[model samples]
Target: MMALQHRYPLALAIAASLLSGPVLAQSAIEHHVWQDKRKFEPYSRTAESITGAIRLSGNNQFATPGSKMTITFGNGKKAQLTSVGASWRQWDDVDGKKVTAEVFKVAKDPGTLLNGNTLCGKAAKYLVFHESLSFGASLLGVAVFEGSKEPKDINSPGLCGTFNYSVD
Candidate 1:
């Protein structure tokens, strides 16, 4: 009986490893679709036109390469995607009007934020503009779940907050 128990765990482990392949493959395909600009459906020109870092509500510094963000798709689906560093001009006075502005290139196409296959859902259809102006240094958006019936809106607290930004 003892020997059987030990072998059962090993068998289960092997089976799990084998089963993970297709899941991983699907993740890869989803990520590829996210990266392909041609696959994106138009959401908002005003939101897409804005250029700035996507600092999560509590984050102090802007999202640089390797920063992580969590995205929730309805139906109990969630994903965490990493930011990849992209070049943009440093913060400068907007129109030299005393207001400063900087560009986070990834915000131009939120899919560029996917670094690996952590985004596992029914595939994101639109990167919807969610909110802005929290912590004075952040912008929030959502990857609308494909086929979802829920309205696109700022539904997650993780995406927006009024507390002071924290550096971690």
Candidate 2:
């Protein structure tokens, strides 16, 4: 009986360790990969422009986990797509005016649906705007970040406007 009791404890301990090994290994290997895919719809110039002579040209591929959208404006201002949670900032010269801006994402009502894929949900559409700056008295500086004044249309493609995407 004494020998049996000692062997039973050792067997229980071995079984416990064996059963926990796969669980631990499975959790260690578990990871999430964001497979969201996007496409850039060619933007058309309208009667009302967001920024004068500022054109947007970039490849749309916001997938691969760390992919980014590089938007180049005609005024030499470049806005790189970044996560709002990380607090990113960019500096550029617009029309020869020095400006600093921050990029962030905001949730849209009903979001944007492309090919049965909805974008701009919790971490969707991005907004790049000029950050408010105040210097000494009489030395105040202000930069205007404007989007389309038209009603919200997810399908509309314009500079400094909504970003439409399709998920995989």
Candidate 3:
């Protein structure tokens, strides 16, 4: 009887573990893979809106002389930005080195043309930036993308990552 009593607890524990195994393995929430909806164009400096090489200056300001940055909205409207002086900042990382973003000013205001667009919306002027030479998982480095102050988030619905550029 003493042996059987000890065996009873052991059997109970085994049974409890077996019964709870399936329950513990099951998950209540469902997960799905996320997909990006927007399309990206390749960078071509030849005969492109921006024809000149973007060179960084010692003063932290850069210029794209004889070149213009073309921003095409989702609605098919476009805004051209001259190679006016721009600012730089150390943001993001590539190959363990800090990535610098050179933000250029828009040449002119597109007015209502930029209002209520699918990407970044409603702005008199847009901020364009060139990323340092760096590559990531599946995407290569050295490109230009849209920047916005109001939205702030890099992955926000704004016009970020819409453009692809290569610096000279």
Candidate 3: segments with Cα more than 4 A from true spot: 1-62, 86-88, 92-97, 109-115, 118-124, 132-135, 138-168
What are the lDDT figures for the candidates, one per model? 0.30, 0.32, 0.38
Please name the candidate that would achieve the greatest TM-score relative to the true structure: 3
Please give the lDDT score at residue 59 for candidate 1. Answer: 20
Misplaced by over 4 Å in model 1 are: 1-61, 85-122, 125-168
Q: Candidate 2, residue 70: CA error in Å? A: 1.7
For 3-51, candidate 2 gives per-residue lDDT tens digits of 8668698887788899999988887522111112222222223201232
Per-model root-mean-square deviation over C-alphas:
19.2, 17.7, 17.2
Residue-wise C-alpha lDDT for candidate 1, range 15-52, written one tens digit per residue: 88999988888765211112221212222332233211
Output the TM-score of candidate 3.
Answer: 0.33
Q: Which ten residues in a row have the lowest lDDT in candidate 2?
A: 136-145
lDDT of 2: 0.32
Every model's TM-score = 0.23, 0.23, 0.33
Top model by lDDT, which number?
3
